[model samples]
Target: MFRHVKSNLLLFLLFFSGRIVHAQSRAVSLAEALQFAQQNQLTVHNKQYNVQVNEARLRQEKAARYPEISGAFDMRYNQQLPTVILPGEFRNLPAQNIPVVFGTKYAATAALEGNYAVFDPERKYNTGKAKLQENISRNELLVAQTDLALEVRKAYYACLLNHKKIKLTLGNLGRSETFLRNTQTLFQNGQVQPVDVDRAQFDVQSQQAELQKATLNLNQNLLSLKYQMGFPLDSAIVLTDTLLLSGERQAVFLPDELKVEARPEYRNLQLQQEQENLLLTRNRHNALPTLRLYGYYGSQAFREKFNFTNTTEKWYPVSYFGAELNWLLFQGFLRRAQVQESKIALKIRHNELLIFERDYVFQTYSKLLAMQTEQQNVHVREANVQLAEKILNVTRIRFENSLVQSQEVTDAANDLLEAQTSYLNALYDFILARLEYERIQGK
Candidate 1:
């Protein structure tokens, strides 16, 4: 009995868990989709990592301004001692040359060295450029995030449009099936011919085929949306947001003038220009000398035997501190070449910034115009859909009263489907254009 109860409890838990999973698969809104994509998209995450890496580089550059300390422990054994010549005048052996082997057979050195740049133009420029580069990386991340959001939004809109098309197709399918039934009933009453029933049946089959196509298209679009959001393709998602074809656009919410500098691309270009300028300055200053301070404090031990543990052995202390000034008088014109290259690159970036501004303006205005046209088109298409729906309804009633033929009802259903599809397309176009405009504006 205990075993049976345990088995039943396991099955109950499994069923309850399945229900929880199903319930968790609720609808997602546009805002939620965009937020989720920004958080999870691989492209955005990679860009974020780039920002972090640059931040670390910035820290490294900043730390370069401080003193560098290092240590080394070296041991050497002399298999054959080196010989050196010495003057014997100090020993009252005038004009005599003496050869002597010096020092112990085994020697070891342990030292700590310190170096600080008193004034290095390269280091100074490096820190500045690193700061600028870090900012540029952050801006790049922003650009990635913006691009991801745009893609996710477009996918979401496509899914919504597809869903609407499927709904319309289903409705038309139902109508066609109903018409077929009515025609068959009329045939039974001897009011319609067999040809009318066959035609109605054909219309129903056509609608079913269309519904199948629409359903497949919807599935394809949903997969694209999931890919954009970095969501699992095997998971199901239902959009909670609906498109309103006749709704007003939010263009008035935007500023009249586009802020070109507000764009991440433009900001990156500006930073590049600044970094290049710093490079040029550094190259020019390369002609000047570099100043540094260096110090070494260490002790060296020497013994006849290899044993370092001998307490009787003496370790000599060595210490030195000095400032150095190194002047590279010339570099075979490499410095000049670098300066010239920097100038050319800076000029190129300047031109690029200008070109970007011009192009951005052009794109923004073009999208604005397209958005306006699509907005107008949406209203027109919406009106057509409503008219088509009315015509379908009227045709159905007339057919039931034996006033219209089966072909007329089929044509009405086709008309309604076409109008709805066109309406959805217009809405999709308008929303996309509006989104593009916002993106170009760097909003």
Candidate 2:
């Protein structure tokens, strides 16, 4: 009896654990979807790394302005002492040629060195250029983030639209089945012809086919949404948000003025211009001379038998400080060509900025017009759907009262479905246009 109880307990625990795992895949709202994509998208990660790389480069350039300090230890063993010819008077010998060896078999030296730039125009310009490049990288990261958010929102809305389509199709299929059943009952009572029954059957089959197609399309859109959100494709996800036409219609409006400078692309272009100016400055400064200050302090030891470690052995101290001036008298006009190139680049960027500003204004105006048109379309489609629904209801009543044929009722049902589909499509377009307009405004 104890073994039987243990087995049941184990089975219960296994079932409970599976439920917990399944529960982890909960429904996601639009806000949660956007947040998840921001955290998980690979493109955002790569852009973030690019910003870090630029920061590191800026630090490297700044370090060059400060004094550089280094230390070293070097040792040498003389296999053969250097030989030198000695004068006869110095050696107290005859004037005949004589060669003698110099002193130590082992030598060692330790030194500390330091260098500081006193004046360098090119280095100063390069530091400024590095700072501008870092700003450019930051703006590029912002661009990537904005683009990803827009893509996620678009995909999310598409999924919502497809979900709505499937619901409408399923509802129509249910109504079609009811109509077929009513037609069959009338035919059995000898009130309707056999062809009428066949027509109702055909209507039901068409609706069923449409429902199947809609279901397939919905699944495809859900997969696309998952891909945009960086969610695992095999995982189950339920979208908790509903697309309402009323909320979107309230957001349509035209701004009095567009802030072109607020966009990251515009800022990036401005940064490029600044960088080119700095480059031009650096090239012109390259012609000027550079001045640097350097100093070193060290101790040298020499021993005949590696006895420098002995207390009695003496060491020599060497110290010096000096300044250097390096002037490039000529370099085959390379500096001149570089300066010209930078000048041309700066001019090109200036023109690009103007072109972009003008184009941005035009696009904003065009999108505003499109939003107005879509807003009108939504109203028209909404009224048409209501009208179609009323017509379908009247046709059903007439069929029951023997005032119309079953084919007329089927035609009315198809018209209602068409109207609803058109309405959903209009809503989809309006929502996307609003999203794009908001993005352009940098909201």
Candidate 3:
């Protein structure tokens, strides 16, 4: 009996542990969602890596200005040593010439060498260009993050809107069910015809279908929101935010002078233009002379046998230091072509920057106007929903008293649903427009 109890206890513990392994539903606010997206989004990570790459490039460019040093070791074995012809007078044999070997059969050399650019016009410009490229990459990352924040806000609002819609549809369904129940009671009392009962039942079924659709839409929106937040798709999530219709209204004032510099794209383009200018300078300087300081120290040994361990064996040392000046007199017109290309690129970027500035101002103005219009529409739709709700209640009461037809009650219900839907749409649109306006203004 003890053994049986032990087995049962083990089974119970396993079952409990399995349940504990399942993750609980997470409740997230809009701010928390945006934070998660910023930290985990793939695009943000990619942009961050791009910034890192440019940083590394900048470091490389800076390092290039420093001296370089290297070491080398070499060994050679000659089966047949090289020989040179010697005149006979050297050997006291007049009018005669003989060939004699001069070098040992084995030779080895060790060397330490270094080179430094003492004067290079292009290095300075190139380093500056690398720094500008790094800045451009950083700005691009900022642009990505800003765009993601706006997307998260929009998706969060969409989910809220859909959730409210589901609630509205469920309320409508409840009302239809109640109306159906009341109509059946009236028919039983001989106060209403069977056709009235049938109509009420039809309304209930239609409302049920509508509720189902609304629920599906809410779920879809929730999934999309999770995707944007980089949250687990299979995990349950509870949005801890409530839609406050009255609190959504805020005063917005457009700036008299738009600051294009506040926008990352504008800064990125500006940096790109600067980079192009530096490239042009570098290309123009490429035709100039380059001066470098170089030196090497080496030791060589030659032996007829493998006797490197012999302390008495002498190794010859050679060293030299000198400055070299290199002037690229010609390169098939490559430097000139590069300079012209860079000049053209700079001109193109300058024009593009101008166009972007104008377009940014225009777009900001347009978004502000649209946001105001949507805000106004939200108010109008709110009023319409209130009126529709009142009409629905009146119609339902009149139908109960046999003063209105079943069709009239159905029409009122439909109008109320439509009004609610319109209000939700207007609210979402206003939120979207406001978010866009803030983004455009670089707020």
Candidate with best TM-score:
2
Tens digit of per-residue lDDT, candidate 3, span 248-312: 66555455468888888888888888888888888988988999999999999999998876879
Q: Which of the two candidates, 2 or 3, achieves a greater TM-score against the reference?
A: 2
lDDT head-to-head 2 vs 3, winner: 3
Model 1, TM vs. native = 0.86
Candidate 2: residue pairs that collide: none
- Per-candidate Cα lDDT values, in order, are 0.84, 0.83, 0.84
lDDT of 2 by residue, 94-118 (tens): 7766788996889988899999999
List model 1 lDDT by residue over 387-411, tens digit each. Answer: 9989988988898898988788778
Indicate the worst ten consecutive residues by lDDT in candidate 2.
Answer: 1-10
Once fitted onto the true fold, the runs of candidate 3 whose alpha carbons sit more than 4 angstroms away are: 1-23, 87-97, 250-257
Q: Distance (Å) between predicted and true CA of 40, model 1? A: 1.9
